[model samples]
Target: MDRVLLSIGHGYSARALARLLKPQGWRIIGTTRSAEKAGTLAAEGVEPLIWPGTEIGPALAQATHLLTSVSPDPEGDPVLRQAGTAIAAAAPRLSWAGYLSTTGVYGDHRGGWVDETTPLTPSTERGRRRVAAEEAWAAVPGLPLHVFRLAGIYGPGRSAFDRLRAGTARRIVKEGQVFSRIHVEDIAQVLAAAMARPDPGGVYNLADDDPAPPQDVIACAAELLGVPVPPEIPFETAELSPMAASFYSESKRVRNDRIKEALGVRLLYPDYRAGLAAILAAERAG
Candidate 1:
């Protein structure tokens, strides 16, 4: 293993992975569409390439592992649209390739449990686009593809605590509305495990053991912070952004057995309670 990871759309989850891998001798090279983010990655010891603008010749040639976390728009996957030829050229040398997808692909499971084998019946256009993107990567000849359907991602700087502190926390009660989530650290572990045990053409669901109600998570965060949980508003009455409202339309508890059984991953924060507590502790330490 050369220990070189080329991360496409190096954002939150990818950054966490970089932090874990760096201390263990992995060289992280990543792409960002913005100049500011490129500078940020450079400061973190990642060799940042400006995608859609910069040529991916050197990084693609050198990367032993590849991870793409970019979401597809209506047009299609920006990465494949931008660098298909270059990626194809580097395919034979790449050891493992991962596409970060969403669990929303199993749309509105009515709070029922869903696994990797569940047929994708996405209700949102976003989920439909993701399904399209997954197929796009799979069709790329000889690319060692692994699709990870990630549940809601919450972490250090992006948790319910931030919302609570900023006075944006709301308890929107929708009966039977439950969501599965994974900590960014857990996501990093899953990706690392997959890299260690490469399974070409594999798909895994990334989620914590607990599938819980949305309002309960907010209440838990408030409790941890010793703040009053905001007044609960019925889902129909609560004013929400279209994006936020879209989330309420689906309900599913995603199973993560494959990641544990295949990749040997034990989640560091197995539930929102543990995840939120760790985030608060980290903030206090700093």
Candidate 2:
């Protein structure tokens, strides 16, 4: 079988995965709605297709692997709604499939730890939608699906450094609250490893070992930048949109032991400190 990945709803995470697969001579077909992003993906050596606007059946026909990072809404999963039937038909032909899910599906754990076996009891509608989406994707027979529950993704342009430099980084003090995070590269590598060692129906939580308070991460970013650390703003007092506040509502440490054990993977940036430092060094290098 040819190594071809049909990536639906290709975004930041999928782009990182492509960076790894493209070097290995894998043909990547990533979908995007924007013409500009399509051009960018093409520049990165990925064959981009305008999706939801174009038929994905042709691409699905040729794919040996499938990956989707699309989020569901009040209605349902877009990939399933648009190409679910096509994906179902392509399942038997696919060697591997991956669904990019959020750890939010595990819901709040009161700063406690959660593993892949944890039950899905999301407090918010967003989390509920993820649980629903996961089930929907798994329902496809012979899909050889692997679900990855990702932590807060940080790297390059999307790290705390950008917020600090832009004077928007906040040290929100929510006592007894902490969250796990993973570097984008780490996530990319883990996904690649999973592909190399396909374990269908496997669900892995992708996160660094360290789960620290949100404020500490912000403080470290300021110190690294040699800027004044942003003052602590109590979570309640902090002015935030509903979406931002929702992040504060849930607090849990996500365990990534399965990825290390099952895939024999070691994290590149294990903690926020190392992750932030690399971002800073990359900036100074350029």
Cα lDDT, all candidates: 0.94, 0.94
Show pairs that collide, candidate 1: none
Worst 10 residues of 2 by lDDT: 78-87
Off by over 4 Å in 1: none
Clash pairs detected, candidate 2: none
TM-score of candidate 2 to 2 decimals = 0.98
Per-residue lDDT of candidate 1, residues 65-106 (tens digit): 999999999999988998898899899999999999999888
Clashes of each: 0, 0
Model 2 lDDT per residue over 1-286, tens place: 5699999888999999999898898999999999999999999999999987998899999999999999998998988987878899999999999999999998899999999999999998999999999999999988999999999999999988899889888899988999999999999999999999999999999999999998999999989999999999998899899999999999999999999999999999999999999988988999
Poorly placed runs, candidate 2 (over 4 Å): none
